[model samples]
Target: MKLITLLPILLCLFTVAAKAQDNNGSNPQEKKVLKLINALPEIIASNKLRMKKDPQRLLKAYIEFTPTAKDKYYQVSVCDDFADRLFAYYRFKVNAATYAIFYDDFENGKLVPLKVWQKHAYGIYSKR
Candidate 1:
């Protein structure tokens, strides 16, 4: 009788655990952020500087959450770390929901859309 009662309890516990595991992958926004983060390195590499005169192995990259009241996104940054000093090569924001990208145009004090930024990137990268 005790074994019979314990069997149902064990089965219930197992079902709850299985459902918890299933719920972990159900968040769509998390999946998008993970996918974009994985691909950012390759995207940055495509536009990297290739001057023979410049030093090699000086660039490092990071992806961070950009805190906001309503809008949410990830910030991808590639920086030059030389002699313990850091200089940002570029910073971009990718929307958490739509995956739209915006470049941080600090000089102009605005966020530039990826399409427009690409036009500027073409000239910067074409010479190399």
Candidate 2:
């Protein structure tokens, strides 16, 4: 008798939980984009720490992002306005589905995994 009485309540709770997990049924791509956008501040903060020199010696460093063709990734570009010039710091390709990040290796002519990219970039940028 008690099991029967509690079953409807359990079903209602489960339905609510499922709905909450889906962001109220919004588009999946939109959710991914929003998640990345929301994380931008933390991302920029971390990259700032990787700088060998103070990128903000004259002005603040900032990061920008745009969806790549076909929307599979976001092209993340870093730059700073200093000394009356736009100084580009680095570029990254962020996966839309997995949120994985890759460094745009202009020197090597290929995208490199972030850990490898970081090792190389941080070597060039950070003092160790």
Candidate 3:
């Protein structure tokens, strides 16, 4: 009778374990950020974008600073080629898989929204 009672408990534990294993893909946001990082070279190659710092270095920093949850975000700034004046800033929302990019003239100290990129399903990012 004790073995019969224990059997149901064992089965319940096994079911919970299997469900946890099935939901193992928990880093979707990180993967989305990495996709953006990988696309940097292509974005620069098109001659449509410019950055003062090396793209690879910036990517490394971005990855390090990116947060895992929705409430936290990462921010970085870029200066001119001379590295003397801040020209742009980028804020990344990992949970939402979006970037809020801003540009500043440095003379007026005003930042204007340059673009917003949102990552969609299958790792495609679209400008908003």
Candidate 4:
């Protein structure tokens, strides 16, 4: 296969592998997520990490993570994956349970409900 033809497949496989593992390192990428989470109260408090719409940082993160904008799961999943990556960086040493909780929350698709927002109350709600 031509290099171009193989690229997308490789990117998808890479993304899946990366998302599936826990690096738990103090890398710059991990640090940035930690910083962003720290800076955002509702996000950290609600377990709601989101990328800015049309974010330049997120564009770069997507390339870094393997772009799959056509897939909503990938778009947000990658960002959520990074936040878990950052949390694990600190958590692996002292609180691995947190990592597991995070994984379960994400895999279960525990998203905040639209109703919660419409009702002006933040609560745990999941599509699953």
**Top candidate, metric lDDT:** 1
Best candidate, TM-score-wise?
1
Compose the digit string of candidate 1's lDDT tens values, residues 8-73: 999998778433211112466644544554355434554364333455534444454543667576
- Poorest lDDT segment (10 consecutive residues) of candidate 4: 88-97
lDDT of 1 at 88: 63
**Against the true structure, what is each candidate's TM-score?**
0.48, 0.44, 0.27, 0.24
Candidate 2 residue lDDT tens string, 1-128: 99999999998977784332221115665455445533554455654664646645322223344456765766555555557566655666778667787767667667777776556535253332
Descending-lDDT candidate ranking: 1, 2, 3, 4
lDDT at residue 74 of model 1 (Cα atoms): 64
lDDT of each: 0.57, 0.55, 0.39, 0.32
Q: After aligning candidate 3 to the native by TM-score, how far in Å is the CA of 25 from where it should be?
A: 12
Query: What stretches of model 2 exceed 4 Å from their correct place?
Result: 1-65, 68-71, 121-128
**Candidate 1 residue spans exceeding 4 A from truth:** 1-58, 121-128
Query: Which pairs clash (backbone N, Cα, C closer than 3 Å) in model 3?
Result: none
Instruction: Quote the lDDT for 72 in model 4.
Output: 23
Candidate 4 TM-score versus the reference: 0.24
Candidate 4 residue runs with Cα over 4 Å from true position: 1-25, 43-107, 111-120, 125-128
Give, for candidate 2, the lowest lDDT window spanning 10 residues: 17-26
List residue ranges in candidate 3 displaced over 4 A. Answer: 1-26, 40-43, 46-62, 68-71, 75-128
By descending TM-score, how would the candidates be arranged?
1, 2, 3, 4
RMSD of 3: 15.7
Residues 1-128, candidate 3, lDDT per residue (tens digit)? 99999999999987784322111123765455545544554334422334353442332213334444654543332222234323323333333435543332334444444442233332233333
